[model samples]
Target: MHEQREFIPLDKEQTPMDTPKRTIWIQALKVAFPHTIPILAGFTFLGIAYGIFMHSLGFHAMYPFIISMVVFAGSMEFITANLLLGAFNPVYAFFLTIMVNARHLFYGISLLDTYKGIGKKKWYMIFGLCDESFAINQSIDVPKNVDKGLVMFFVTILNQIYWVVGATIGGVFGYLITFNTEGLEFVMTALFVVIFIEQWMKEDRHVSSLVGIAASVVCLLLFGKDTFIIPAMIAILGILTLARKPLEKGRVSVQ
Candidate 1:
């Protein structure tokens, strides 16, 4: 019997013109969207509440959509609502935004290597690095053959879409809906608590966790709730920096 060989197309120009370049994006979306389902539910409800809140304050529907797209930080966007109502203080608002998002610094540090070679997509990744995106992208292992950058990008886009859609609908129906949404704001708090617990469980040592709690408590006692976050962040960074050598030595010894 003659040996059989698989036929190969040797001509480069024979490649199909419509070969799907978009397949990567489609695959990424398929993989990423399911991971964000919980966030979809949460952001949608919160966005609607925010839109209703803005509507009640006489702002237009565009306000929520624009803010959701631009700021994209749920907690900070809510604070923006209050800032709009208060006296103009750009300096305070700037500091408050930095304080509220100080966690991103840690996220950036953790993702430095993960994002090193993603090229231009890195900018968008950084811009859209919300809590949900960071948690999902950091924790989950990207499946074989899936583009990690595209997956992360889609997660960011889908989340923003959910929020904007919810907020827009709520704004449009602001006067039509009269249901009290008390305690709805607690969703974000509960979400973060779950994230914190999950992160704590994944760690070998609880040093960082303990430091966070202790620092926050100390700051809250000293500065009160409204002003505690900034000081707590400062303290946490200081403590972690000071402890870095010991932590690194311990990690090395374990390995």
Candidate 2:
């Protein structure tokens, strides 16, 4: 008879039959979760505010819940809430929504290389690419062993979940609440500023950052708050595209 071997128990984190896919996801989530903490705090409060605003507008809690799930466009959802209260105007709504979200076009282009080869996850990545998600994913430097795509996928999904959960809670309980949300909208702007600073600290050069600032200021001065977003995004995109080669070279040299 052959010698008997002793049985050994495997930990939850380990499995003999586990595929690389599962392992990568575990590693990715570990890396991704920390980066999304800021977004979680910001989205939670803002999403609640959005839910409360909708409830105050005579819409049921389901309205915010479903809209947050479907639209996932924070600013546009608020505008859509108002639109629903008025006479139907698909044409106007279409143009207005496009104008409001025009910056996403630039966002998509910027993420093309990052999101490529991500397989089916690319669809959800594109869908869930909100402001906070974009900011975090764009600025993050994933570890060599982790899967960048999975990290981004988790970041996108977690942010969406935070928004959806918050909106749902607010919708379900907003009537029982009575608090001031006057300045809550600024949370997103504050988050962006923080992310910008983080990115600035991580980078060797500030050319791109400075370009973004100058473009925004000039556009805001010329087009005003109501109309500057699209122009600013366009300016940023054009400038960055033209400077892509220099930026790549600088990055390589720094590395």
The number of clashing residue pairs in model 1 is 0
Which 10-residue span in candidate 1 carries the lowest summed lDDT? 7-16
CA lDDT, every model vs. true structure: 0.80, 0.84
> Candidate 2: which stretches are off by over 4 Å?
1-23, 178-186, 238-255
Candidate that would win on TM-score: 2
lDDT of 2 at 114: 69
The TM-score measured for candidate 2 stands at 0.83
**What 10-residue stretch in candidate 2 is worst by lDDT?**
6-15
Taking the tens digit of each residue's C-alpha lDDT, what string does model 2 give over 53-171? 88888889999999999999998999999899999999999999999999888789778766766667779989998888898888889986666777899999999999999898777
Name the regions of candidate 1 deviating beyond 4 angstroms: 1-20, 88-92, 178-187, 253-255
Highest-lDDT candidate = 2
> Per-residue lDDT of 57-170 in model 1, one digit per residue for the tens?
888899987988889888898899999999999999999899888878988998876665565767888888888788777776688666676687788778778888988887
| Alpha-carbon deviation at 59 in model 2, angstroms | 0.3
